[model samples]
Target: MSVSSHLLFFFSSLGAFNGLLLALFLLLKKDKQYTDNWLAILLILLSVRIGKSVAFYFTPTLDKSILQLGLTACLLIGPCILAYVAQSTLNNLTMKRLTITLSCFTIATVITGILFPYQDYLALWQYWIYRGSSYLWLISLVVASVMYARKNTYKLALSKQLLTQQPVVVLAGSWLIWTAYFTASYTSYIMGALSFSLVLYLTLLLALKSKWQEKASTTQSKYQNNKLSTEQTTRFSNLLNNLIETEQVYLDPQLTLPRLAKRMSATHTQLSQLLNDHYQMNFKQFINTQRITKAKESLKTYPEMPVEEVAERCGFSASSTFYSTFKQQTGMTPNQYRTTEI
Candidate 1:
């Protein structure tokens, strides 16, 4: 192989290898969540499919069964993407429903592979299964995008929303872009592998940058002798209370310090200072306090409601966080607090 071809092979194959390794790590992770498992499955499927593309682009005589496996991986990718989106955003997909849906698709793929056997049915596999799987990927991406927008209240313009640095949004957008590349006839077959490489590296860079910023923010003094005046402090205090109590912005699990500061027509630094000096807490603590208070009320008023539902209603994001925070604040578990009364 020429140096250029070797470079292309290296560039594309590196991502697939790294993706498989990452997927294995996620699978073996002790503290992984449902969404994490789905994400791991997604990485595995994408890596397999992309690896097939890289191999087939260089070697025309690749095994038929390998081709079939790659396409079957494509068939499974859509469902995995959809499941990840649903579990991450809505958190309402029951394990039973997920199992049934994936099982049906897996069974169908296995049966079709057995009967058609791409070695003999190359035309059918290339024309029908390939196109069908690509379209399924596209449709899944569109549906997942709609679901995310609806559930997450993504109201920004298309350009702005796509430009947002949120991980889930970025993942969906990257998949959509990859699907477009593969579905278009003009694009090279190897472009999908290249695209995955680019996406993976970009995601890693963004993640590292985010962590660095978080560490920098923590190490540096946020306010650094910044203090609000008495009158300014009083006015801001009332506004903050109204925003939390009357508007109940704390009910949004996606609410962040910067978002709340924007709602208050203040800068995050100013808001942070006020929260620290006046409330004796930081943004997360203050928000969790409000959420815990709301949870306490719900637990008392609705004894029959499931703890998970209560956690969701109270903006806890995850039941584990809710349980921990409830215990920390009230010196008891939510159930104990509920049953013990005042």
Candidate 2:
């Protein structure tokens, strides 16, 4: 085979291999909804490109027909796929609307293409118009994906302090791929098509690598946080247990933190520090969680009791305070919660 033929096969094999790898990854990790959808869409694109490459190798004369078909697919389904991937990744309502819009445009383009098969000058004009629309859609898809990736990175960064740089690197790499492929001067169909395929493959590989690294880092951070959180929880649980079981401090309607601290034989400052630093809760929330927990039990078992009586039994000083705390925590007042019981 000639060098050109050899190069075609090489790109085709590489594209198909990448598609199969992505498909396998998706199948293996079917539980992750976002990654699975992305891999699935990517596999579709790769498969199509591979077929195009193979067709190009076997029949050089049908190159224009093949190019037209490939570009048409790219124009029609490319945006939809990108939009779907963006929506899945970000789970954003805005992206959903964008996906819907792209789907509608794809439908319209298909209808137009079918009505006017490109044989004459007018049909050719119509074809180019639709093709331009597809390019515009592709541009939109690229922009949306970049925006979603940036937003996802920002959210991840805000949630964890250690995850500062991974998102930025992924975003930068993606932008670079887009820039290199789109800004090149070689307007030949083969070069353009190959460049698009190369950029997409590289983008997927980098994205998956960045995502895996981010998840690993996130998992580690979560494990550490959970460990620390559990320790705080245990300490608080012990404190509450002592308050309810041994000292019986909940029986005091006016059980302030200072008084409870005195009864627990710890300084008020030390108790306050425990609530704030370890539990990351203020004294009011700590006391109210205990009160509301007790109130829930009372409401469940003592259905005949008045709401006010339940409030008083839970060591709440007033009915209003009990109602407010209950609503704040459960999104409903005590009476409403009781009414919906079971």
Q: How many residue pairs clash (N, CA or C atoms closer than 3 angstroms) in each of the candidate models, in the order given? A: 0, 0
Model 2: lDDT of residue 183: 51
Best by TM-score: 1
The TM-score, computed over Cα atoms with residue i paired to residue i, of candidate 2 is: 0.47
Best by lDDT: 1
Residue pairs with colliding backbones in model 1 are none
After best superposition, candidate 2 residue 185: deviation in angstroms? Answer: 5.4
Candidate 2 runs further than 4 Å off: 20-29, 46-59, 63-65, 85-96, 119-134, 149-189, 192-342
Question: Residue pairs in steric clash, candidate 2?
Answer: none
Q: Write the per-residue lDDT of candidate 2 for residues 197-285, one digit (tens) a residue.
A: 57556666666775796567446544443332555557655876777766556644545665566555544555666778776898888
Q: Write candidate 1's Cα lDDT for 19-132 as tens digits.
A: 899889989989976577888888999999989989999998999999999999988888778777767555342534776788898898999899889999989899998888
Show the lowest summed lDDT stretch of 10 residues, model 1: 154-163
The global C-alpha lDDT for each of the candidates, from Candidate 1 onward, is: 0.80, 0.58
How far out, in Å, is residue 245 in model 2?
34
Q: After superposition, how far is residue 301 of candidate 1 from its true place, in Å?
A: 11
Q: Model 1 Cα RMSD, Å?
A: 4.4
The TM-scores, one per candidate, come to 0.76, 0.47
